[model samples]
Each structure stands twice: as structure tokens, then as C-alpha cells.
Target: MTKPQIVWLRRDLRIEDQAALRAAAEAGPVIPVFVLDDETPGERRLGSASRWWLHGSLQELGDALNARGSRLILRRGSAAQVVSLLADEVGAGAIHTIRHYEPWWVKAEQDIAKRVDLVLHDGNYLLPPGCVVTGAGTPYRIFTPFYRAAMAHMPPPAPTSAPHFHAPARWPASDRLDDWKLRPTRPDWATGFVEVWTPGEAGATERLKDFLDVAAEYETTRNLPSQEGSSRLSPHLHWGEISPATVWHALDGRQGKGSESFRSELFWRDFAQNVITQFPDYPDRSFRPEFEKFRWRDPAKDENAKADLKAWRQGRTGYPIVDAGMRQLWRTGWMHNRVRMIAASFLIKHLLIDWRSGERWFWDTLVDADYGNNATNWQWVSGSGVDAALFTRIMAPLTQSAKFDAAEYIREWVPELADLTDEDIHDPPNRPRGYPDQLIGHREARERALSGYRAMKAS
Candidate 1:
């Protein structure tokens, strides 16, 4: 007899090219289920933005499944409890899902496996975890070497088509998705965001097509926040509405300067996952131990510093570039990679705040907020991460903005500054009509930042 199988959905939302679902279907009748228990992270439920994206992506996945003569079975509560209950109810002999690397998930999966035959797949990554390791079986410590090694190991996995599936004998009852209340209604600020984002697997493929068709100029235009030079696939990738494998497969014939740059960015994603694999604490704590003693500023006590964070978050910072990035994040729940670096540097260095604080905000707000990327990127900017910039290097927002046409970006987000031409808007004017003065007097803060750096080194 063909034993029943449950293809449990987690981050991997798409039925197309889904290793878990394909594996289950090969066996016999398969049950496609998505459990909305954010407790996979053990008390760390999904972030607001992630939950919002999840609601939309799952709706699309369900619609796709319904078209394929199946429906996404929804469940809530603990992974082990829910999976075991469904397994018994359906007489399912096995459960399968794309493996995840977060510590909380690592633990939960182990517990779930105890009750049911869980078939795990390394489907989310391009080469899977620990595949591209160092000579001694250690993970690559840094990105450049990691990227080189990753490229050498595989060109790109062949993208798979949505598998033909078989339905379960009986459909399981599901919770009304509306009751999930993942979408906000009381304080609806996401309408603009929703209008901008095309969520789900199908949407992800369209985005990939758009990027490849026009990727030749990404090297030059990507930095300009005003131009849509990016793939904007981060949210989709985060939710597993699409996989890195799908992306690599899709880019097989692409050859251009921008293709390499784009691949390099994706390599960073693999690199970050490798970091999380070796060090589960990569999200909360610095990988390097020496800098653990580094003293972070207390925004509550530091009136000037508190003002700086407020300015950055509210898009009111006197620095046009910084304000523009912050405002972009507020309005779109996303920011350009270059602008993200500038804004992150300003918060951690210029403002002398903890990177963790910035990480928390991005976690809550960024629609593409992957735990691995958000933590790694924040650590990278703060120079507290394992493969981060040295603590001595500080980003000059003024020079960076000028270099990247920051004024152009500033005009888009900070409409108040739109009145001032780019040349006049790069720096704060002596007495601008509506704009605030340089929030902390950046020059003074630069010196203070150096002093704090010295203190940290001296400690």
C-alpha cells in the first residue's frame, strides 16, 4: 500500500520546483499543508511585515493549488503537535518540508521528526548548507572566498517546473485565512506597500524576468534609489515563494557585468546562511568575541543620539541621503542596497547606537526581512559581524551621497527637500525653510565616534 504523505509547507511556499512536495508525490497521494505557527522560532513569532507577506503569498499558493486540483491545508499551533495531529488524522506516514537553519527551527524540526517520518530537503539554498565547505570541512569564514568556491561547485541548479500532484483521499478542514488577521485593518499603513509589492511565486518569476532583461545597466544604475534597477525578489526569496535554485536556474544564459554583480549579491545570501549554519547566534551576537566588550550608546540618555535615531527613522535627518533612505523604508518597507548601507552606517557609527536596535526595526518593517540577511547585514555595517568591515572604517554620508547622486534619492523620499535642487540639497543649508539642521553636527559626531572607537579598542 502507498503510505500517505504530508508535504508540510514552511518558508518554501511554492508547489513548483518544491523538493518536499515532489518527494511526497512520488510516494503516493500527498497532502499539502501550511502551518501558520510562527512558534517555529520558539517564542519568536513571525515579524509583522513577514506575517503580512505570508498572508498574501499563501493566498496565491492556495489559488495555484486549487487550480491544480488541490487546496493548501492550513493549521495553527506547535509544529510537532500540529504535524502529529494531522499525521494521525490523515494516516500520513511521513511529513516533508524544506529545511530551515534558525536555532529555534532546528530544535522544532528535531522534535517533529520524533513523532513522524520527516523527510527534509535542502531545497531553499542553491547548494544546500555545508556543501561548499573549506578544506578541513569548516564553512568558509568570509564571502569572497565563499563566492569563488560556490561558483566553482555549481553553475546553477536546473529550475524545476511545478510538479503534477495527486490529491489526498479526504481534504482536511482549515482555519479561515481571514481569521489569521495577518493584514492590518485598524491602522492600515500597508496599502501603499501592497500596491508596490507583487508577492508570491508567480510574481517572483516575473520579477526575475524583468531583471534579466534589463540587468546590463545594474552596475551603474543600481545605486540610484530613484531607478528600479533591482530584482526586488528579496521578499519572495525570504518567504520561499521562490528559491535561490529557481533564480540560479533562470539565469543560466545571462552574461553581462551586471549578471556577475547580481550573482555576487545572491552569493552573499548563501554566505549568510552558511554563517547561520555554523553559528546559530549570528543574528543576536557578534561572531567575533573581542568586540563583545564594545560599548554601545544609550539612546535614552544621549539626547543628541536619541534625536539622531528619531531623525533617521522619521526621515527628518538633516543629511538628505540618510533621511531619504529612512523615508524610503517607511513608505515602501524596502530600500536600495547602497542606501541601506549608508543608512545603517549612520545609525551604528554616526549615531553610535547598537546594531541590534537597527536589526530589530528592520526585522519589524522590512517585507524582505530574512533573519539571516537582516542580522548579517546589520553586523556587516556595524563592523561587529564575523566578515564585517573593520571598526576603524566609518562611512561619510556626505561623500557617499554625493558620490551616488544621493540628492536624487533624497528628493524622491524627502519631498520637503524636493523643492531644493540636487546641488543645494546634498548638504543642509545654513537656514533651510522647512528642513531641520544637521541633526547632531556630523563633524562633531565623527570625532566623537572616533573617540568611542578608541574607547572600545582600549577596552
Candidate 2:
């Protein structure tokens, strides 16, 4: 019998720079498999936008693999059962995949390993979570210490090149990629995603190359929502089409503030993963126990609160910067990091809505919605995280917009404001005819948020 190993492609979707694929090919003949399991528990499922993105990404991966004389086998249902069946079908002795830290994924990997030789690789993160810690050997709650600790770890391995002469034992029957119907069927809301993105590993490489060409200017330009200074690799990274290691290696030779700043972003991702690894339920609940009793404002029961949330979501909050950020996310599946901070702060602090609602909305909508980053970012903005800002520190989106000169971004996303002066754009002089009025006055909202925060801390 020819010794064979299975390469389980999860989010790390690219052929070139794939650590698990390289490892499996070196072992013996390799079989590549992708399983779609919809029954994952204690975690939310992929939203419509994510489903649409996955469809295109998988199609691209299939084409890439076919070009390399291999095929991707697709199975749907229970992950452990599918892997076990494929192992028998291919007569494979081992399974190799990039390790993932999501709670649901951790369980599935454990179950599969009990029945077979499951070799896991750290391909998703720049540094393995829990690898970095204080001298006392405990995880750091604050990002500064956590980020410093993560950087102290040996840098991630250089990205692996595509493997050679590795062919599958046989082409196992794959469910037609189209049959998954991962894309939208009716009321197609993905025209923006289609126009904004090119999904897959091939696109991932192009984006990285483009960003590197202009990296010297990135630190200054990345904050502009309308600017193209961003790497735009989040979807790729989210899908595992590009590894963090690939990004780290590409910038290794550069010695500038730009390189240092970009590296911090990667470290932040590592910091987030470390937090989630320590507290698996971090996304749905608070990391700090006292927040469990935090009296979050209830939008569902209160008419004013419900209207406030509606205004925020619909881009009619009467705060130009906040409206622009929300509109940007609505029109595109992504948002600028700075805008994300502004909108989240407005929602959690100004509207006094619960952060979870904002988080769920982003989780449903963002192409780069990683559990750790999404959860921690929301908590950070809402003053609910371990080292969060003081709740009394209210962020007025109008002030933020002026500070950042976000008129261009606002104009692009909300054309109704295109004619307004920059000063007037940040805070409207009057309610525009097509747009709604302020649902909650900014100063009043700030006071409510501060009072609520005080009540929580008092507990």
C-alpha cells in the first residue's frame, strides 16, 4: 500500500505558502479535503456575506489545485465523520492541517485526532497563542504587555513555497462547488463585495505585493477611509489564503516606521488570539468577570433605545462621521480600522447599546471577522475589555471626523453630504430632507453611557 497523508485545507486556503500542504507532501502522496460542517455548537454560523465570499474563494482554490495536478474533495456534514471516512477512502494514515484556536474548531480537531494521526501546524497566527507570557508564566490581559511578549517569541517560520510532484492517490468524488449555493440566491446584496474584492490565494499575493510597493507611505495614509493605502489582505488572511508569516517575511528586510507600525498590527492579531485561547467564551461574554453585571442599555424594550440603534445602523445617527463609517460598512463588506473604532465607540458609548449587538452586526457583515480581533476591538471601544478606556471617556464621532479630516470618506459613503462644507459635514447644520434627525442627542447619550458605566463599576 502506498503511504498517504491527508492535507485538510481549512482557512489556510493557498497552495503556495501552505505549511500543511508542504508537510503532507513531504510525508507521502497527499489528499486534499475541505469539509463544511454547519452543526458547530456554542458558536454562530457564517453569515450571508461570509457564505458568498467562501463560495468564490473555494472555487479559486479548486482551480489552483487543479493546475497543480491535484483536486480538492468537498464534503458536507459532521467534520470528524467526514475526515474519518476520507481517511478510510484514501487509505490515509495521517491528517495534516493548520491549527485553529476557535473553540468549536478546537473540539472538532480533538475528536478527529483520537481516531487518526492528526498533525497540526501553526499556520494561521504569526505566533502561537499561549507561547508568549509574562515571566510569571501567566497570560497578559493588557495588549501592550501581550504584544511585547508575542514579539519576543521567535518570528514565525518563513512562508512555505508550493510543493512539487505531489499528486493525489485518486480523485475522490467532490460535491460540486456550485451545489453548496454559498452565494446569494435572491435579493443579491453582494454586488459591493464583487466590486470591492478578488477572492483567493492568487488575489492575496497581488494585494500584498501592491501594499509593499507603497509601504513607506502606509503609516500616514492608512487612516483615510477612502485611500487605497491599506494592504486589503484581511479577507485573504481571514480565509487563510495568505498567512501572517507570509506578510511578516515580506516586510522583514525593511527598516522604517512603516514596517514597525505594520508589524504592530500583526502583533495585535496575535494578542487577540492569545486572549481568545485563554478565554474561549470571550466573544459572547466579558473577559473581566465584573462586566457580567454591567447594566448594558437595552434597545429592544425601550423605544428611544430601539430608535437610537436603528439610526446608528441605518446611517442616520445625525453624526456625519459615525454615519459615514456605518454606511461604508453597509456598502462594502469592510471598514477602515480607524472608522471601525469611531463607529464602535459611537454605538457603545454614544448610543449606549450593548457591544454584543454591534459585534454580531460586524460578525455578520465583515469579510475579515476573526473572533479574537472582532471581540476584543468591540470591548476595547466600549470600555469593557481588560485594559479598556475609561467609560467616562466618550468619543464624539463629529469631533473625531474633524480631527481625522474624514470628509472625503464621508462624501464617498454618504453622497447626501457631498455638497456640505467639511466643517458642516462632521456635524450637520440641519437635518437633510432624505436623512433622519438625531435619534439621541450626543451630549445626553454621553451622560447616559457614563452613568451606566458608573453603575457597572459600582457593582
Screening candidate 1 with a backbone cut-off below 3 angstroms (N, C-alpha, C), the clashing residue pairs are none
Which window of ten consecutive residues has the lowest lDDT sum in model 1?
38-47
- Write candidate 2's Cα lDDT for 343-382 as tens digits: 9988888777888999998988888887888998888877
RMSD of 2: 1.6
TM-score of each: 0.96, 0.96
| lDDT digits (tens) for residues 392-451 of candidate 1 | 688888888888877767777777778777677788566367778876777887897888
Model 1: residues with Cα > 4 Å off, grouped in runs: 300-304, 430-432
**How many Å off is the CA of 196 in candidate 2?**
0.9
> What is candidate 2's CA lDDT for residue 341?
91
lDDT of 2: 0.82
Going through the candidates in order, what is the number of backbone clashes in each? 0, 0
